[model samples]
Target chain A: MLIKKGAEADIYLEPFRNVLHGAGQGKVMVKQRISKRYRIPEMDRQLRVSRTMLEAKLFSDAKRAGVPTPLVYEVDREDTRIVMEFIRGRQVKLILDSLNPGLRRKLCRLIGRYVARLHRAGIVHGDLTTSNMIFTDEGRIYFVDFGLGGYDSSIEARGVDLHLLRRALQSIHFRITDDAYRAVLSGYRREFGKGAGEVIKRAEEIGRRGRYIQKEARACR
Target chain B: MLCLGIEGTAHTFGIGIADSKGKILANVSRVYVPEQGGIHPREAARFHAVNARRVLDEALNVAGIELEDIDLVAFSQGPGLGPVLRTAATAARALAARLGIPIVGVNHCIAHIEIGRLTGRIHDPVTLYVSGGNTQIIAFDAGRYRIFGETLDIPVGNCLDVFAREAGLSHPGGPNVERLARRGRRYIQLPYAVKGMDMSFSGLMTEAVRRYRDGAHLPDVCFSLQETAFAALVEVTERALAHTEKKEVMLTGGVASNMRLRTMLELMADEHRVKFFVPPSEFCRDCGANIAWTGLLAYLHGVRQRLDDTEVRQRWRTDEVDVPWRGK
Candidate 1:
């Protein structure tokens, strides 16, 4: 049964068995990239296939880089689909505001640390929003949704990735943005080490370029 | 009550008269065309200053109202070239001072949205405002209009304009590019960048230009550019629409005049079973009518702008201001 009709993919939850790693019965989430009738058929197919492969690669790359991500059990290249381990945990987006200040800070800090790990390995979680995260009952954060992500080690890509996260915090969790962002920065600085400052500075610069920071105003000229 | 609005944000100097009932009495604009290159802010401001009296008088004459009969004055107060914004602001202040009426400064971005809503009679909409310098998807929530998504780097319209210039097209090249795109059959592959709801057009622009220089057909490159950029925009707008669940969608700003964009958005809106609105192209572009209407909305809501507080904010953002006129 179709569970969620996302723009890029439709998600389905079904029972599965991990035959490769011993008999383990569990639920797996199958995400299929739905084709759009609006896009030209040729380009649409090309994008779907390439993006599906890209996302699967991102999952493995991120996992190997020390980030906790859902394991990709199977990939259907032609259908542009993936069957991955289903995360049975509360999404960070829904529970963020309900958490105590201390817990919130710790959770946000963990999120920052995971992002640092991804950047350190030259990967950007492109859609780095709270909704794209799952806070396991085990007190760990698992990143999801590599749909928009790309494999790039450039500082601009890394910085833009963080900036996108900051924007998410401001828009969705406005109340705790100040503390949440600061804690995230602290954790990032701690984990990222020598290269953290440059990425952080670039992130700030990227933020300024958006409509929000508009310092030098000139247009249509 | 009647309010006269002045718009000189970039290259156009316009004057429009509107009543409190959201009726536009008269809207006249004089666009300053640069001689050789891009618009020079100082020259544009001088154009606005020189044409201010005639434009204001003509607007009043067209509105069938005397200067003394005006109840308020409004002007575009920002996110634009410094000299241009100041020129419009000075004209508005002088008009209000001479007429002994209150004055309000309108945010250029919000003005575009308001004009669409007011004219289209749309209650609330996911607005895809695309212009040469700005591309923002906005929706009203809580007590203010918030940006759902926007361009991360250069806006979509700018991408087309720059590519047009490189293709040896004249200034204001969007239309010329669109015309050429219609005749092209091939779709040269171009970069399509959409990160969540936000889009990045610089890469697409760079690749399209590089393809043109690499011996690809000009029309093919133009077609590919439009296809890629417009698709990215439509995709982002669809995301915003899905997220907000707004029943209506609006397309406005300078780029709204493109028929292909309108068709693409219309199709997307149809697929989602949502209403699609595009105010007449005249009111879609940067105009005095939008400023006048937005100012009237703010003024009627009891928002005041003291003379000391009427300074133009070159960095004004759409989400930064409170929309007292709109309710949840």
Candidate 2:
């Protein structure tokens, strides 16, 4: 069944036995990158195939780095699809604004821990939004959608990732973003150690640059 | 009552006259064309200051009103070149002080969206504002226009203009690039940088210029540039529309004049089952009418600026402004 349709892909849920060897009514997700008719055909195919492969690799690498990501089962680059373990959880985006303040802070911290781990592993979740995160029944956060991310340890890249997260919270969770994001930063510091400071500083810098804030400061009448 | 608005935010100096009845009496603009390169802020400001009298006279002449007949004065107050902003602000303040009328300092970006709403006669919309200085997907939320997505590095129009200048194209690069893109047959690969709701075009612009210098076909380069840039823009707009669940999609700014962008946005809006709107080409670019209209809305809602308080805000974000005129 087509469960979710994202910008560049459509996700389907299939019985575990259909893709894996054994079955106990478990379900696996089959994410297929859809070809965008708006793009040049050859370029479109190239982007989809490459992004599919890149996402799979990033997921695997992140999971190995002590972050909670859905386990990858199979990859089909030719068809631009990936069959992964299904995450049975609610999207944080839909529930974050309603959760109790304490629980929300805890969840935000957990999100930060996973993000710091990913950054430590030289990976950046390019599109780090609440929508891309799932809060499992196990009280853990699973980060998904590495389509826009890459293996970059540079502070600038990592900072840009954090900036994306900050911006997402501001726009989507405007009312409660300030306190939640502060907790997220605390969690990041708790996990990433001293390396977290420079990254966070850079993230602030990136945020100002993105808003053209510095330009105004310099060009003030 | 008549409102005279002056707009000198970038390369253009425009004057618009309007009334409380949502009728634009006159819209006149004189654009500054650079001799060899991009706009020089000082030069642009000088141009506005020098032609301020002439444009004001022309606007009043077009509106068929005398100077003392104007009751309100409005100007694009920020998010633009500092010197250019000051020139426009000074002009508006002078006119208002002499006429003993209230003056409004308008946000240039918000003016674009308001003008679209005024011209299209739509209530609320998920707006894609693409101009030389901005690329933002804006929607009204919480009594203000919130930016759902925007360009991270450089705006889409600037991306096109810089590439055009690099390739030795015309002064304003968007239309010229669009004209050449129609002749291209091949598609060259360009960096597609859509990261969540935000996009980056500096890398794409850099790469396109490099390819053209590397002996790539100009038409092919232009085609690929527009494809990557516009596709990224449209994707973000679609994402914002879906996220916000807005029933209408509007495109504005100078770049809105490009048919390719208009068509892409129209198709996306159709796919999303939302009403699509773009004002006539004249209203798309930077102008005084948008400022005049937005100013009127704010003034009617008790937004007033004294001479001492009419300071321009170069970094005034769209979300910072209170839209008392827009009901919750």
Candidate 3:
């Protein structure tokens, strides 16, 4: 069954098979990076292969760093597909408004801690939106779709990652974003320690830079 | 009743006369084309100041109505250059004072969407507003035109214009680039930077220019640039469409004039099974008719700006406005 069709990849729910015994296993998600017709064929192939490999590695790294992520079952670089454990949960974005206030705060703080753990491990979830997160029935938050994820230790990269999440929250959950993001910062500071303050500061600076660029563009116009 | 709208947000200073029924009786614009490079705010403001009288006269003459026939005055109230916005605001203020009519300050970005909705006969659409200064995917949700996605860095049109300037093309590089891209066959690889729903075109522009400087064919470079950038735009618009689930999709702003972009958006709309609408080219570009039409909407909804409250907001956001006209 087709799960979702994104700009870069198409997600499908397929049965996982045991290769050794030719036995049927449970369902798994197959994320295949489709070839873009607009790009040169060779370049498109190269990008798909490299990106598929990179995403699989990043998912494993994130899981090792204490963040909950879908376990990778297999990777087919030739087909630009990654078969992973299918997460049975609702997207956080869809359930945010329905969540109780206390539960929402707790969930946001948990997300912040998970993000801190990833940052400590030098893994950045490049696309950190509520849609990229899932809340399982077990009360655990699982990150999914690491297509834009990367290994980066730079403060700028980490800051940008947080900035992207902040923007996503602001756009998607405008009413609760301010309080939710504050809880996230509190949790991040508690877990990440001294570096957390600096990263937070850098995120603010990055936001200001975006506004400055917009102002400059307007002035030029 | 009639409204006279003054638009001087960017390079164009226009005067449009429209009735309460949304009929544009007259629309005239005088754009400030720089000798070279991008727009200079001061120069553009001066152009508006110099041409304001002539444009107003032309619009009134075309409408065959005297100044007294106008019942209200409107001006683009922001999200634009400070100097340029002030120039238009000043003209609007003076005209309103002389005519003893109410003045309304309208959001320039919202005006674009309102004009599209009015002229194209589309209601409650997910708007892809792409212009020289702004690029945003917006939808009316929760009593406001909420921004679903936007350019994280430079706008799409600015990227195109700057790249064209670097490539030695004429000003307003969108059309010229489109013309050149028609003859190109090769699809050179350029950076496609769409992060979530937001897009970044500055990197793509830089990469395209670098390729052109590295002895690549100009036409090929232009084609790659358009394809990559427009693809990013289309991707974000599609995401917004999926998120909002609006029944209609509308395109507005100057960049909507590009056939390639229009075709891409049309295909996306078709796939989503939603009605697609784009106003005529005259309505697509920055024009005073949009301001006048939107001003009428606000006026009918009891939105009136006092003389003291007519200040221009250079950084006004589309979602900041109450938009009571679009009642819940």
Candidate 4:
């Protein structure tokens, strides 16, 4: 496997390619490693192995629930990384930035549905950055990187996940304001049912309280 | 031996006396209310100039301890408003010099933890220290307090106070919000931002004001706002305990007096099977009693500062102490 290194972890891209050689025609990618330092060799090995196992489990769980996530090809716990299907298109951020408002709205609604599907399966994406989502060449959206993911049914957790997405959309697609964000909420409600509305409402409450605090502090200062 | 601690941090001037043990013989505080807004350093200092002696004398009288009975003098060193800190430093140096006693400068945050230990006896508990001036989740490591998590921007109480103003509430906004929140429903939804162990309140505050302007019920909005913000704090505190594997949690600082916040922390502790310790209302707020009690410990352990060693620091962190660790 050819390993690609980033600032935080190493990514092995060749494992999926080699696995697909037997299938004759397919492209795959792998992101199965977390960097370790300071721990003893044995502890590092254990941490990496456990993290890889968690990632693989998270991937399969999301896939079984029909969430559009990368297909896990192979997981090597000892090496602390996994190989998965290679996404062909760029991050949703790039597309959202370059597209017109209409396309941007469409993409946000699509992303909203995808997120709702994941949360419905009781999985909370701890990190929901724009960079963590990819837009396929065929216009499909795929969620990636379950490194900080976990299972939780708390409305707060789900709300926080959606909040991150909303913030990401607003920050990344700066042109889109509350109206577009509400559209994303509508998409979440449509997919996740009435529960999404309650969750979104709660998320809005959190956002409001946060803003009041800041404005007040500034005014006081 | 008797120890006297002076705390002139933020807008409060606290005076306390403690014995060799952690028993607080007396504790007194003088509060400064800025006419226009938040704590103004110069104005607060002026208030302290006039009121410090009154509070100190009252505390001494309440404790029934004379100036000669004070064997050790302590003062809050930093992580507070500079003008307030100078007022405290000046008092401690003067007292220590006149009384011929050693002075020990204590970190205000650490004093909170130590006082929590005294009041609730959670020796190695994770601490959620939230006040108008500071917000942090702390654990004892390597002899000093280590910050496990903290607000990325404003402190929680300050955030609450800010929102209170937007709601047209009083200056010390937390208690006022809690008072008015009971009348509100949980309908007005807001954002809850907990990024890893760290949290942020800026976005949520902005959204809350917008919703209020749009005619959201003020009471319901206040209730929901407190619920979400307190919930975020609970989540972060729980995460810190889980991460550190500590089974005891301590809540400290001025905001600790809020019943709603206490209830939230209590529930989280219950869910995690961790014992939660909250100091009595007096110790919970910004007071010199905690400082006095904590200084007593340092004095017992032979830690002392010369009379001339009274240097006021505006940003002294709790983790900067060079003490030896005593594990649980």
Candidate 5:
């Protein structure tokens, strides 16, 4: 297994071990080893093992919900990472930046519907952003990195996703987002049905309040 | 040869397809019909998803292309609704996968500017994007699009949408009020909130709604409201032109389709001897030709995304892109 390391863990890209060329099945990127700074050796080992299981479960749920997540081929609870399917796509946002509004909204609406499907399936992508998702050459959006994913039907979790998008739009594009953002909302409502409106409203309010609190905290600093 | 694109950033749901050369094949948008009040995000998202499928099919059918012939699938990536984003991403992914072709994710706002670039015929121009979800003046600088002026509070389109709701207009209140304002006898004076390059619309919206509640005709308020807000936008745009010294100004996004705003900016740009470019209405609103163009650019620049990069993020920053921009 070939390994790639990040701040949190070392991902072992299995299925490509000792291979000198590209694997026709695509790459299986596995996040396997995470270092624990706070726990004793035994406790750290157990924590890593459990988190590996948790991440694997999250990936399974994501796949089941048609989220185009990397399929978890295998997992070693002893390690923090699990081997999974490697997708062949670009970040959806990067693609968006290169296109025009018409296409941008179309893709965004599709993304909206996909996420809605996941939400309907009771999966909350705790960290939803343009960078975390991929758009495959096959036109499939495979959502990767389920480290923070969990099962939640709470409006707050969903709202937080929306809030993150709003902030992302404000911070990322900061241009030509008006109709584009609303289009995303329209897609959301279509997928979630009537309950989405109130939820979105409440989410917006919560987002506003959250920003206000953050601003105050920053001022205090 | 052609690709269908959809946009749902704010209240307006736009559908458009473009050819390989950045030509709009077909474009359509259904503005949100605001209820008793302003737009409800979730309601708007629902409307988009329902209308988007229909629009997508319409565009594909109109262009006489099957799912398989869609050489590449393109969709907006983010800076919008999570649910809505998911909807678009899912549709594109499914379509691409089903067709066994490539899928390209395009940024909603950048597409607007790219379309403007193609239509306006400017080498490098200053952009004033005013819509429901965003309000900013942008200029290309340091291999990235830099913001020169923006709304510190709510977006311009959101402000307009809210005010339009007060005026009994639909979700995308800009056009509704624009139509009604034509017949209104008087133009009331509203606050023009512009500070340096930064602007404010929340206070203006609150006041406009209040005046409407205080017995002002919705039409007059609408006309005056648009004029006030647009005037502020124009001032900042001119300032950007002055600061950047760019001779060409390109107007994109749904708001760019507004004739009054376009005319005002044109005249302002004219005063500075700067040419102003507003794309044809087809390019103004959300559409996919921009995506095709963007995809082409990314592919050309060797910025293809790896398969292991699969992660749906609610936040993606544009400056983070490592690709170097060499303007034409």
Candidate 6:
């Protein structure tokens, strides 16, 4: 079944079976990068193939770092598709208002910890947003969609990653942003230890740089 | 009420007269086009200072109204070059003080959207504002215009212009590049940089220049550059539209005059099944009318700035200003 048609990719739900082993079977999500008609066909295919392969690698890297993510089952570079374990849950963005205050805080804290772990493993979720998170019935939060993610250990990259999340919170969950983000930072510090402080500091610096650019741009105008 | 608006934010100095009933009586503008390079701040300000009176007089003549008949004065207060903004603000203050009319300072970026909304008759749209110095995807959320995405480095227009100049094309490379791109049949590979909702164009610009220097066909290089940059823009815009679930998409800013960019945005809007709007080419570029129209809204909503507060802000963010005219 067709799930969602995003700007860069189209997602579908399908049942997958291990034909070689004839043993394991489950539902999977097939995320196919859609070819943009405006792009050259060869260049488009190259981008799709590389991005698909990178996403599959990042998923495993993030999972190994203690972040809950959908398991990658197969990567088809030729078709620019990834068949991954289908996550069954509600998007956190849709359920944030419905969740109890304590649960919401706990979920955000866990998300912070997960993000911290990913960063510690040199994985940056480039498109970090509440919409990219899923809350399963089992009370676990799963980070999904690593299409824009990559392995980057630079402090700047990590800061930008967190900055993206902060902006997302400000935009999507403005009501509980302060409390939720505070919990997130605390949880990140607890999980990542001393390194968390540096990343948090860097994130603030990045934010200041953005403000500075705004000011400079205005001044130069 | 008759409101006179002054706009001298960048390369243009304009004066517009509008009434409370949404009638634009006159809109006159004089642009300072640099002979060989990008705008120089002091030069632009000098141009504004020299032409401000002439433009204002032309607007008054076109409107057939005396200065004493104006009920209010509005001017673009920020997000521009310091000298240029100061000149316009000084002009606005002098006019208001002389006439003893209420004066308001408006955000130039928000004014662009408000005028587009006013003229296009669009309500609550995800706005893609692309210009030489600014590129942002904005939508009214919560209480203000929230920026969804923006250029991380150089703006789309600047990217095109810089590349065009490096390739020996004239200033304002957007039109010339577009003209050349029409004849290009192939798309050379160019960097496509989109991080989340934000995009980066400096890399694309650099790569385009490198390819041009390496003997790649000029038309093909231009084609690819535009394709890559515009795709990143469309991707971010499309994401914002989905995330906000807005019912309409509006394209405004100087770059909105580009036919290819408009076509790309329109296609995305059609796919999302939302109304698409772009003001006429004249309004798409900077002008006094937008500032005037937006200022009228602000004044009607009881927004007024003290003379002391009339000092221009070099970096006025669109979200920093409150939109009392837009009710939550």
Docking class of 6: acceptable
Alpha-carbon shift of residue A141 in model 5 (angstroms): 53
TM-score of chain A of 6: 0.91
lDDT tens per residue, model 4, B241-317: 75567889889888898888888788667766779888888888888888888788877776767766668766565
- Candidate 4 CAPRI category: incorrect
How big is the positional error of residue A67 in model 6, measured in Å on the Cα after superposition? 0.9
Over the stretch B1-328, how does candidate 6's per-residue lDDT look in tens digits?
9888899888889998889888889999999998877778888899999998899889999999888899999999988878899999999999888988889999998988988887887889999999886898999998899989987677788899889999999867899999999888887878888887778888899999999999999999988888889988888998998888889999988889888898888877877789999988777788888888889999999897889889898778887899999987
Off by over 4 Å in 2: A17-24, A211-221
Candidate 2 residue-wise lDDT, A1-221, digit = tens: 88976666788999988777775468999999987656668777888888889999999999999988888989998999999989999999999999999999999998889899999999988889999888889888888778788899999888988888998998889999899999999999999998899999999987778545534443443
Quote the lDDT for A37 in model 6: 62
Span of 10 residues, lowest total lDDT, candidate 3 chain A:
A15-24
Off by over 4 Å in 3: A5-8, A17-24, A34-50, A209-213, A217-221
Off by over 4 Å in 6: A16-26, A38-40, A97-102, A211-221
Summarize candidate 1's per-residue lDDT along A1-20 as a digit string, tens digits: 67777766888987775423
Tens digits of lDDT, candidate 6, A1-221: 88898878999987676421356677778899988764557766877888999999999999999998999888888788988889999999999867899988888889889988998898999999999999999989998889899888988888888888888888888888788888889888888888788888988876665532643553456
B101: Cα error in model 4, Å: 1.2
Residue by residue across B23-71, what tens digits does model 1's lDDT show?
9998989998878655678888999899988888888889998888889
Candidate 3 per-residue lDDT, tens place, A1-221, comes to 88887757889997777421248577888899987654446556877898899999999999999999999988998889998989999999999877889999999999899989999999888788899899999989999978888888999788888887887888788889888899888888888888898899998876665532585655654
> Which lDDT values do the candidates have, in the order given?
0.86, 0.88, 0.87, 0.75, 0.66, 0.86
Q: What does DockQ come to for candidate 2?
A: 0.49
True contacts kept of each: 0.29, 0.38, 0.24, 0.03, 0.00, 0.28
State how far residue B248 of model 2 sits from its true place (Å).
2.1
Deviating ranges (above 4 Å) for candidate 4: A1-221, B325-328
List the DockQ of the predictions in order: 0.44, 0.49, 0.39, 0.04, 0.01, 0.43
For model 3 the local lDDT of residue B235 reads: 70
Clashes of each: 0, 0, 0, 30, 95, 5
Q: Which ten residues in a row have the lowest lDDT in candidate 2 chain B?
A: B264-273
